[model samples]
Target: MDFQLIFLSVPLIFIAYKLFNRLRFKLPPGPRPLPVFGNLYDIKPVLVRCFTEWSQQYGPIFSVYLGSHLNVVVNNAALAKEVLKDNDQQLANRNRTKTIEKFSKNGMDLIWSDYGPHYVKVRKLCTLELFSAKRLDALRPIREDEVTSMVESIFKDCSAPENKGKALMLREYLGMMAFLHITRLTFGKRFMNNEGIIDGQGQELKGILNDAIKLGTKKSLAEYLPWFRFLFKAENEALAEHDSRADHFTKKIMEEHTIARKKTGDTKNHFVDALLTLQKQYDLSQDTIIGLLWDMISAGMDTTTITVEWAMAELVRNPRVQKKIQEELDQVVGTERLMTESDISNLPYLQCVIKECFRMHPPTPLMLPHKANANVKIGGYDIPKGATVSVNVWALARDPAVWKDPLEFRPERFFEMDVDMKGTDYRLLPFGSGRRICPGAQLAINLVTSMVGHMLHNFTWTPPAGVRVEDIDMMEQPGTVTYMKTPLEAVPTPRLAAHLFRRVAVGNV
Candidate 1:
């Protein structure tokens, strides 16, 4: 080798050594990411599944830069406690993507707000006013009525001679039910009828919400690669239009509520009525009210639908589990009458199935990604400030060490243990944990459990003929929440009498 070439190689070697040492020593252990794209290619499609796969390669706690920003995925139940419990106050701030930020109106709502007095006050107000245990219990009839309407509609469909024992679009029906439920709870009336179709102005508002959710969840390149900001300009413009239209519709509803509440002396107890009362008490802005309303409608409706759909899909895929739940329902909630919310406590098997579903397919799998406000150390690695930290609840629930036969849809595993799902036990925190835990967890529990109970008690579900249980599609469509790639189509035969599906003339639904 030439002496001049040798002289140049020494400096290059020293520089390379220093760079590699800094990266290896400073950053948390994780999958080696590409230069510009970072971990985008690795976690494409479903971030939860990709993060789980990486947890096996690197330890449970590892960092992967999502493009330019560092994202640390915490998949360990033990290490999760460190972030959600030990340092919840410090790490309470939300780490939103550009897309999430675009819709948030600069952290206007309780869900996306940073950890501060505003978040605390708003959260407290919302929890007490809308979703407290007492509030949910008092409003339980709203959910019960919606469930009644849903079962009645399904019963009517099943009663048809041609539709008898035919495959019903379970996901579509559940989504409609959730939509009607949240609508009635928010506005005190059903915009969508029992047939799962929306009416006139309601139809227009539905389109607006649908368009916003679709655009909000659609991944944009600028979110990952900042230099490609020009790529999302068109998307940003479209979102702005959707936002403006949606805001107009929301404002109209608030205006209507304002007038109605004024006439009725603000005596109503529905969600909007409650918010109207709190709006005056707290001096909250109209924009804040709209953002909070959007949060309720967007979160309460879709996530509930997806979760119940997952549970039903898993049941239809596992006939033995279906039979077991049906048997429990039959025993606890007899054929003469329908399953009530109170009956949920008597049916342990149904609870197990619901819990298993929560573990297997959590509604918000990534638990709304959080941003670290300050430098923190976890699992013996340094997480620099401003890194996006999200717990891979999907991965944690399926950990082989924590769960036996993690991939199996066995509800029996839950029956054998006493693990709780209210984010108390980190192992199966479906709703999340800490200061930012889901405010509506209690309402969700009541709604999901009661709905599932009613469904199983009212019908006998079976897969379409010739489709083997193992052959059912379990593939997922990743978005704001991970939903089944295919709609769950199953045959529902009425197990209970038709009259039981209806309520008295004076009662709702």
Candidate 2:
């Protein structure tokens, strides 16, 4: 009986292997995938590097497998334009990962939800109610206030004798500035007062929010293999616990604001207040509100912050480009006051610099994964309805065919060029293209322009006394968004202070 069972199992195993091979679908030629796990092990840890490398070998478009999952990457401007834009509706849905599906409260957040009624409604709310141009203008003062706070903080640091002489980690400071500003915009209160930060606990809220952003985005084994998810179920429980704490904090702030609004009957519109109103109008669940706020926190804090850091790093690396930008800022925005949104419109050189930054360092590198709703053909290859489509914005921007001297940081490329970063020209979409583009596009751009302008106008930056310009650590680290592998630390020499002859002594704190 045992011999017969063993003999029977041999053929069964053979048949199973054959079946798995047969199930393999035709895809664009890529590195050969192994059995069961497919090409999962072959893909690089940094997705941008993998895509950039693969595009070289596979032409503009290629197909690869991720543990049996099919992902089609569009690496050129023409394909990205034709496929992601011209044929958008057919591929409008987000590629639902097991993890995104689970944590999104069963497909609730804007990023994970499919292209249907739910997505449409949420998009409309965000576009019309939350982030409209008029609404953004109304919120401008809040952003200005935040930038002012940041400049003040920098000034204080520069003034401190113990801290004055040392190079400051501008990336860390910029990230915290972005976070606190976003949080204040949402909560409509200075939760982290200036004194609080000075007292060693002011930035704690920003620190917690940053921690949550990192946690939520950290790639997990469960994301790739569903069967092994039970092994790290503790992560899910921990995330939920963190969510509860975040929710409590948000809800408490909302409650206080709501009570004050009711008492005074003042109907001043703020983001949190607007969301509560949305809750009533849409009959949104409590979890939905919390989840949506979490999305705002995560997206707002990380992407915008990383983008600004990249822009600054690029500026620091290319002094000629940086000088041109400062020249524009000086002409458009004089020394009497800080740069504002009104000045952003006339600063073409500055705008070009920002676009160049996007070209070099797109926040996502690969725009969020989009799923095909029905079978479609891109680049003569038939992609099934359920397959995942990734628009390699990073690769597309850097493709030598599309960009002249693609690797060099050149903002002057856009000096007279028609390609804007507004997603209209698919050749250079930083915020993404089609319906899935970032809703925070306008606000993000405005904030970046204002901040960058302010930085250039206020200070002249340099590498530390001994560090060579070429040796400034430009290495990149992998994350949901790329940051300098080593943080951007620079010695900020105040131009105005230097002119006055009061030497800002650099010291190690």
Candidate 3:
């Protein structure tokens, strides 16, 4: 009898141990995690939507397991502030996936660099040397020239006898234009702009860079279950291939710059020149500088194009909106010339249209992962040290509690209240908010808004042949920067006076 009683008590002891382990973490409420895989089975095609659904069921803050990693997703404004602002210092380090770290060159650049003295120093350098208002003003000529070149290129293509009134790939045109603008500004050199078209080796190099970035952004089950990495051998191979191509391309450019620097001692006023100037002061190497250059190109080029394309797609889908914006532009900007960057603020409706697009389609939907430095309480949940915290701004943008008709695309909504995008406004953060907000926010905004303003001022866009307005696919490819699955194709006919289209171009106005 005594032996039997001791055996019965053993089962109770085992139960108590399991309970203690669960209680120790004090993790926020979430769906029960399964053995081995955790919550991996629950993730959907679109991560933001999946998080949005989970937020509704588990409240604003909840814990999730991507394999063994604990991810705390914030889906509301107040909680976003608590994580992104109140505890920013504790959560300043980026939570890089293994693949991303390889692409970031082990945190050599701005976007993926860990929070530390070097990150701080480099950020200051970028702020002062690259993105300062004075620097931006000085680069106005470049922006104007590129914008005019893009407009001229489009007009030429559409006016051609073979392509007249046909569906021109607008998004493709804009993507190349964005690439040209960024590369030219970055190195003070131009490529892929022969006859105002992106072709030849310029296109090839851009493709290689894009392929590598896309590889880094691609989701990996191995990130969660490290031991299962062997299952993703194909992904690993693709990553290495693209990474090698990117490294080769960037190194070639670096060599060219070095040769130019030595021959004439003529430093072009560009990012590479600035970094080379302080190479000794910062103790930076060629590899480190190349990594940083990749960071800038990866972060800058595609996002501006994505934003402008989404904005244009929305406008074309809603003709009333397109008409309304054109009327506003005609009134304020006038058909006499293209809109200037300085005139951005003066056109409130255009701003509102941009705000609406950001609301629906943010460039970085997950706002880049931020890792906790130490254990902290966020929204009454135990966010363990080293845990990843991601603020789903897309979920917040569509929170009915935050906005009326959260999913609807309505620019007029902005007219009712004052909403800004300068990282201060959590409600509409296209460039994110708080300590880790995008360093290049000002430049990106100017690129997107100015492009849209000029496009609206100069042309009347309609849905391409055979495509109904309602048929536009707003579906996005899931990644760090969600690109439209179907490229935006449109028929752009110059609505402005012929002289304004021809004489003023983009920058002259």
Instruction: Please give the CA lDDT of all the candidate structures.
Output: 0.80, 0.74, 0.79
TM-score of each: 0.92, 0.89, 0.89
lDDT of 1 at 288: 75
Worst 10 residues of 3 by lDDT: 500-509
Candidate 2, 375-395: lDDT as tens digits: 787887767778788888888
Q: Give the lDDT of residue 106 in candidate 1.
A: 67
Residue 290 displacement (Å), model 2: 2.3
Write the residue-wise lDDT of candidate 1 on 182-212 in tens digits. Answer: 8777766677554556788689778987897
Arranged by lDDT with the best first, the candidates are 1, 3, 2
Cα lDDT over the full model 1: 0.80
Q: In candidate 1, how many Å is residue 194 off? A: 6.1
Off by over 4 Å in 1: 1-25, 193-197, 503-509
Between candidates 1 and 2, the one scoring higher on lDDT is 1
